[model samples]
Target: MTTARDTILARLGSPDGDPAAEHAALRRDYLHEHHPDVDLVELFAERLADYQAVVHLVPEGELPRALSRALWEGGYVIPDGVPEEWVSGIEPSRRAGADTDLTAVAGVITGCAAAIAETGTIVLDHGPGQGRRALTLVPDHHLVVVTADRISADVPGALALLDATRPLTFVSGPSATSDIELSRVEGVHGPRTLEVFLT
Candidate 1:
């Protein structure tokens, strides 16, 4: 009665693995935040920009207007659960699905679960405003909305807020890679452009 999961675990050399025991074995003394005095939101924006992602700081109650200006062209995909006010005036938005034509859209807009300052990563749990994997991956551009409260000082703090059982997408700027010749290229695996509007 060996299950597929059990077989996979066996292959990985942890057939009888105890989740609690494994977690306890890991070191917990590591410093969670490298710069305690630095503001998490500021640090996050800095790191994201360093990765070549465009970062915008939006004032409170102005997210809707900012979103409209960014995706003004209007062929973008809007996943379910995104706030109505966010996309209210933005017309011609496509609903994402398996049949979505990635080529036809300008990009995808979604909200993030948590943002890590140290790594400048946006972690999405594919819940609510955050869409499924394909909605974000197949598009050429990705525009995310990150709130100030969602910004974490470090990865450890960010992970504490996420659900491990849910599907997670950790985005650090746009998708890119370097070949053996040291030439860099963008848009290989995900969106070529990542624009973040921090509110």
Candidate 2:
């Protein structure tokens, strides 16, 4: 009556072989990232842009101007933890609850935990400057501000920087999918536009 999974468990639980010993027998090291010779910032930007997302590299103090120019349409909203100075010229409507109507806002700007150079993925642990999951999902546009030093070399490095206990959202680009007939549809499930500012 024992299933294959049960048999495997029995062997794994045997006195001779502990899980740690089994793990020790396997190769534990591999290349973490490729082309380490290249600049990490450039790699991260290229990966991010490859996903159909626009990546902006701005000067240290120019985030406010860059954000304003990118979010020129106005009506932008932000999470509570987002710094007020980031949106200097625009009035940002605040949203505290998860059910807020995000589509009404022209864009939603937040901060990311880490950016992956290999995958062009941005990780959000719903931490400070990052609101609930709905904030990024419901809004038509997502504008994320990240620092250049926050870029990780690869997915594993990014994973190491994240807190698994928190809600994590990995966004590579705007929400999009191709239909069966080969037509591409955007914003079907999440934000249609993704903007990243690497300062």
Candidate 3:
């Protein structure tokens, strides 16, 4: 049976090409940083927007009000460890975490361990305020709160803030995919809406 690699090898007239050597060559050393002087929070907001996420940047003291206004429609629940005051006006009845069934919940709010500006990704290590992976995933909407100090300038910087052995969940955007015909669909595997509050 002719595989894609075999077909490429045949076209290159190198049927004896070594796959292992090709793999090694592709694993070359790479850059670990970029734009050291650029504003990471700004970059993070821009990248997050690019992924179709609604990002809000608010001053530290204004978080509660900002959070209340964003979720005023009342369709979200806060995960464990998410400071009570952050979702104060949103109604405590909605908050739930740790082994809760989130499938029917409109959204779940939680804090993140670190955020990567370069990739616009939020990493959750199930830390204090961040709940289990399922808490953020099963719900159709995710409201994430990120502190300024948690936003890293690059992937390398973000990695440096994480513990290697912990269970890590990196969310780039609302779960979405395109079919073979190029039609796009969302919420196929995770939340279809991601609202981020970057403090």
Highest TM-score scorer: 1
lDDT of 2 at 10: 73
Q: What is the full ranking by lDDT, best candidate first?
A: 1, 3, 2
lDDT score at residue 48, model 1, on the 0-100 scale: 99
Writing each residue's lDDT as its tens digit, candidate 1 over 1-199 gives 9999988776555747877877777779989889899988889999999999999999857887787787635377778888887777566534445356877777899999999999999999999988788888988889998989999998899999899899999999999999999899999999999999998
Model 3 per-residue lDDT at 7: 86
Model 3 alpha-carbon drift over 4 Å, by segment = 1-30, 72-75, 97-99
Off by over 4 Å in 2: 1-7, 10-27, 72-74, 92-100
Q: How many pairs in model 1 have backbone atoms within 3 A of each other, for residues 3 or more apart or on separate chains, i.e. clashes?
A: 0
Supply candidate 1's per-residue lDDT for 122. 98
Task: Please tell me which model should have the higher lDDT, number 1 or number 3.
Answer: 1
lDDT for 151 (candidate 1): 92
Error of 2 at 128 (Å): 0.7
lDDT of 1 at 22: 75
Each model's TM-score? 0.83, 0.83, 0.80
* Rank list by TM-score: 1, 2, 3
**Tens-digit lDDT track for model 3 on 30-147?**
6766868888899999999999999998887788878777653435656667887777766566555455566656777889999999999999999788877778878887889998
